[model samples]
Target: MTASSIEIRRLTAADAAVYRDIRLEALRLSPEAFGSAFETESVQPVGWFAQRLDGGAAILGAFRGGELVGIVGLMVADGPKRQHKGTLVGMYVRQAARRVGAGRRLVDAALDLAAQSVELVQLIVVDGNDPALRLYQSAGFVEYGLERHALKIDGRYYDDILMAKDLVGRA
Candidate 1:
């Protein structure tokens, strides 16, 4: 994404095509990073995305020249204990979009949106993604704990650190 031309906006049902493209790209290139696979989601019905947006999930897309370059998903739960918390997931920025502030903007959008109904936001990062870890930290996320060998990718186990950020001014 270009420095001055990138736009960060809420993703709508009409942006499902762009969403699918970015999602598939993530799963294909970084299959170990996420819980789902391209083979599984690549064939899913389009209604899946439409229903997702129609529901309560919040999505943000970073677009440059009308092309989606990054995306983040925020899901707010309804339970008493979890109502004040939002979980961050499905965060990805295109390879071409790296180093251009696109990732930070996408994350900032998610964090800002989470502040509406959630007093805190939570996410997990594969320990090896140094840049992402730094970005999350810069955005006020702190490591709380690590899940030992949480993911088994390609016959190897990788640990992930749980991170949380408290939203200030929330009662």
Candidate 2:
């Protein structure tokens, strides 16, 4: 599918079921890429997922041919000292949607929302995920640090690369 065919929108509680399905798929297929585990999130009720959409964090979804195919989230800090910062989290694009612009559009939408309330946006990608790393970098995110053993699954450890983009002068 072409990039022009992908539709990006902020998800609501009404879209929780599709969101949950896509989220579980991501965790199951790419276990090392996320901090959350499929086994942990799989048992949660749909209401639990709905609550996440209803929560303050901005969760954006990508639609292709009227189906939810990808999702990304942005969460701004609520504390007094950290309120200027936000974290980009739970980025995933279905295998079928790979190589299209859905992932990039989702990131763009999340960053656009983050720019509204936070001066900087941060994200962590698994060390070996070159596509995701390149996507973030191409979008103006710069590496700040690396966290060793950021995720441990099935007796294996994975490192994470920390990246951030300053929104101070972004239009």
Candidate 3:
């Protein structure tokens, strides 16, 4: 799968299982990039995923012939001062779909949604995810900061780099 063979759409309750599956895969593949681990999320019940289906956040999914292949999440920052921002998380594309534009499409939808409800969009990427970092940069996201030793996985400390893009106005 490539973007040419895929279609992007907002996720609904019916997609909860697929969402869970993809997210679990992401955590398993890159334990450093995500805050949650497979050991932790595997314990969550289906209702937990179900309850997240429709909420303040916008969940985007990429599908190829009705099979979901990519997903990205958008959630509002909670607080008065930072309420104008949206946090992008749980972003992942299947291995076969990596080189294609599926990931870009997923993020584009998330950014568009963020632009509507928030003025800025932010995300945290693991320091070594160069391909993803480049993609985000190409999409107008800029590295803002880094949380040193932000994540610990497999007994190694890793830094999480924060990146953001201003959507309401310009970059």
TM-score per candidate, chains pooled: 0.93, 0.98, 0.93
Least well predicted 10-residue stretch by lDDT in candidate 1:
45-54
Candidate 3: minimum summed lDDT over ten consecutive residues — where?
A: 47-56
| Stretches > 4 Å off in candidate 3 | none
Q: What is the number of residue pairs that collide in model 1?
A: 0
Tens-digit lDDT string for candidate 2 (33-64): 98898999999999999999999888999999
Lowest-sum lDDT 10-residue window in model 2: 108-117
Query: Mind giving the per-residue lDDT tens digits that candidate 1 earns over 1-171?
Result: 356788999888888877888889998987767878788999977778777766788888999888999988999988897798899988898998998899898888888788877888999888898988999999889999999898887789888889999996743
Candidate topping lDDT: 2
The Cα error of candidate 2 at residue 167, in Å, is 0.8
Error of 2 at 25 (Å): 0.2
lDDT of 3 by residue, 95-132 (tens): 87888899998888888778777998999999999999
Off by over 4 Å in 1: none
* Candidate 2 stretches greater than 4 Å from native: none
